[model samples]
Target: MPKGIYNVPEAYNEPVLSYAPGTKEREQVAAAFKEMYNSTVDVPMYIGSEEIRTGKTRDINPPFDHKKSVGKYHEGDVSHVEKAIKSALDARTKWAALSWEHRASIFLKAAELIAGPYRAKINAATMIGQAKTVHQAEIDAACEFIDFLRFNVEFMTQIYAEQPVSSDGIWNRMEYRPLEGFIYAITPFNFTAIAGNLPASPAMMGNVVVWKPSASQMLSANVIMEVFKLAGLPDGVINMVQGNAAEISDTIFDHTDFAGVHYTGSTAVFNGIWGKIGQNINKYKTYPRIVGETGGKDFVLAHPSSIPAQVATALSRGAFEYQGQKCSAASRAYIPKSIWPEVKELLVKAVKSMKMGSTEDMSNFVSAVIHEGSFDKLASYIDAAKKASDAEIVVGGGYDKSKGWFIEPTVIETSNPKYDTMCTELFGPVLTVHVYDDTKWEETLKLVDETSPYALTGAIFSQDRYAIEQATKALENCAGNFYINDKPTGAVVGQQPFGGARASGTNDKAGSVLNLLRWVSPRTIKETFVPPTDYRYPFLG
Candidate 1:
């Protein structure tokens, strides 16, 4: 019983606040960071209308200062995951039946809450829990997440507006119904925005969700749950559970009500879940939707005509920002031999200039990796590169975990184009470079395309129009989000729909209508004005 057509507020990207010196945002975030850092919080699993704290708890430690505990989150077992699934299923009917505008209003309110009251708190949590610099936290936990909520509302309305054309004697319409069962949302720790978005996107489409956030991100994830509760999201609409990933995934995938998964994690993990879903396909009531944005060995390829200074800046920022943990972070670079000396000099200087420490100091451009495991992995890679005959550590081959999991921004120059660092994903503050001959621009593009199993993101820098065009065409299939004269990271929500094909992911393009379409099953309705009583007469004539 809807009374009138409703239009959501005009959606726009939330303005990113510069937490610069002497600014109000700077003071607010610093205060919040200090308060959260000094306090210890206990987080529990959310199922239905209850907060279930299974006394089994794990401490939430900051990567930049591992010995200090900012909080602890209650860990769940298989039973807790099962309860979360049941909660989502039990709540699905009422949630899906709610008016679409109501759903839109809830998310829009969440956006405002994030933009206004919760901005500093969420950003500080990201800084403490995930080790992101203030700028990184601002762009991610604040602006990008706000954009995802507001723009998704607009995208939903657009999807609802799409209808079939009616003939003169008939009427036609389309009804987009939520999937038959619940959604399983698995998010990563690299970006707090992604952690919020993976579940919020599906829930915005009226599908109930069972979300499992990464353990390393519990602090910021708890803030997101708070925002959702304040924004008036109903109980059990999105049940959040944290524990063993395998146990949670197994419990969800084996259920007959398993409808779909929205995942952002390692390529290996995504593939593993896809296999599990395939094995359980026979048990499901409907074919499940699988959407994921996985790992990336993203690249930056420079033409001989490219400016050395610009290319150097791109690599410095793209490879070291957030310690290069981003899925789209530039892990590999192909620089022309003509400009190699200048680019190398500038890049080395930039890396040497960055100060790495805790995010409390706004001047620190780099911070620790997420955990000890990442620190060890990056150290092993740096050690291996040091001994490799064809590779040399150009700069920053040092690491120290005595205080925190800090790895220096390292660069490896390899004579071999297929060196392990160039082809593999390091997912740390490491960049590998291959100096190709300037005349071999086309050949280098081919090499770049063929180098990685991933096709998530890549950037081409060039001053020559013809070279740019040629590189663009040659590298089309290698990057889902291709950038011209820029770094591969920092993709905005509405401006660049992000995802990939091949080993990267399903390329569903999260942030656009294409992604939202995956959550609904449309039914076409056509009513004839004249009954088909004379149907046989037309055939006879």
Candidate 2:
């Protein structure tokens, strides 16, 4: 719909079936295809019984099963957070009083449910709603969230076991306590696992949560809620609300009872929320906790000694995974001149091999971008990059939206580091390749830190110890999560804490104990057998 971008071809409107023809196989595939297509059209899921008049709507285009309805949400203004806060406040008392074992039990149960019966439904919903390949959807709906559930339970147990302090004849212990009030969780559409963990973390820590999921991810959210319910999560312990930003913000920020906010989205929105909280800082009974992860223009650096084949593989996954929609997706590549030719050829070949088609096509890797609005933005960036400098479109750089939102996996070779595409966060299937001279590697590293405002995730590919050390130090302040010879995108739950600094995020790395820590407040409870009357220790005396 927007200028410069094209729509998906009409030929891809229907699901492409390649199974052996038979009554059983035909019926099964036909039914699956039917369900997939039906999820594309917008369907409303009301939360609080208020009519949402916001004109915002999803485009249920083809390639996506047109008959499949997109989930709609009717979330109205919570002019007063008083009720939601009260709900959470009350819920927290009972939730927190439960032993760690109880909480962990339910969490594990939820994970089991997710992996068991809900897997197919969740996978299907994600693939249709987000246009994810079957494997990608399965990874998100089943694997990632399941991992988060199991990991958080283990991590929270460890945090609880940490002891405070003890002195001669005096023993003191410190315990983590949940905020007495409600926690508001605002999640992003990119990772549904984020949606599950953001609210669940705080809930597990004995705080009640109010979740505001991204509209694009409502279907996934619904499936997650189902899992939680099946796990026997207490009624009203977690509430899902969907609405425009204004209504949600007005409700949550203005509430005096809100104890914390967990958010992941654009920097602008995060900053705006921060400012509002600052303005009303004195209105709250307790200091509110704020944790967020925002945007990123992650980088992938290739050294002279780096293998050309490995670099290509990493870049290909980083640049095009989820259509470059991931916050940590590598958007920039700085390849040394020595390995530039080899890296370039391999990368181009790898890009060419990526299959582009409907998600139902199991082999198709490239699917439609989430919606038309995003497609338009991607097109603008590509066009602006072309006009602003001598940037060349290396591989693919167009869109076709006749049936659904689809963009070719695009790569651009730019001569100028300051090219708009190189600097900006293009959350689409687009990558900018910049070749650098080996002699000027240090200067290039400096340039990387300087040009990009985001520092979420960055990687370097090299075996040289000195080179790795130098680059690491130089780019130390560049990314929150740094990698060596690894793709920045596929961050594991327990191993690599995912998040960035600067414009990228609040540095609250998800999938780690750090994220769970953000949900709680540690309080020291000192008990002495003799009730020390004087505030003097044996050492001081």
Top-lDDT candidate index = 1
User: Mind giving the per-residue lDDT tens digits that candidate 1 earns over 1-541?
Assistant: 5398788898898998988899999999999999999999999999999999999999999999999998899989998998898899899999999999999999999999999999999999999999999999999999999999999999999999999999899999999999999999999999999999999989999999999999999999999999999999999999999998888899899999999999999999999999999999999999999999998999999999899999999999999999999999999999999999999999999999999999999999999999999999999999999999999999999999998999999999999999999999989999999999988888898999999999999999999999998888998898999999999998998899999888999999988899999999999999988886554775687
What value does the lDDT take at residue 61 in candidate 2?
36
Report the Cα lDDT for residue 221, model 2. Answer: 76
lDDT of 2 by residue, 147-208 (tens): 88888887787787788768876778878998867888999877878888889988988888
Q: For each candidate, how many residue pairs have backbone atoms clashing (under 3 Å)?
A: 0, 23
Badly placed stretches (over 4 Å) of model 2 are: 1-71, 79-83, 532-541
TM-score of 1: 0.99
Record all residue pairs in model 1 with backbone atoms less than 3 Å apart, i.e. clashing: none
Q: Model 1, residue 227: what's the lDDT?
A: 98
TM-scores, in order shown?
0.99, 0.88
TM-score of 2: 0.88
lDDT against the true structure, per candidate, is 0.95, 0.77
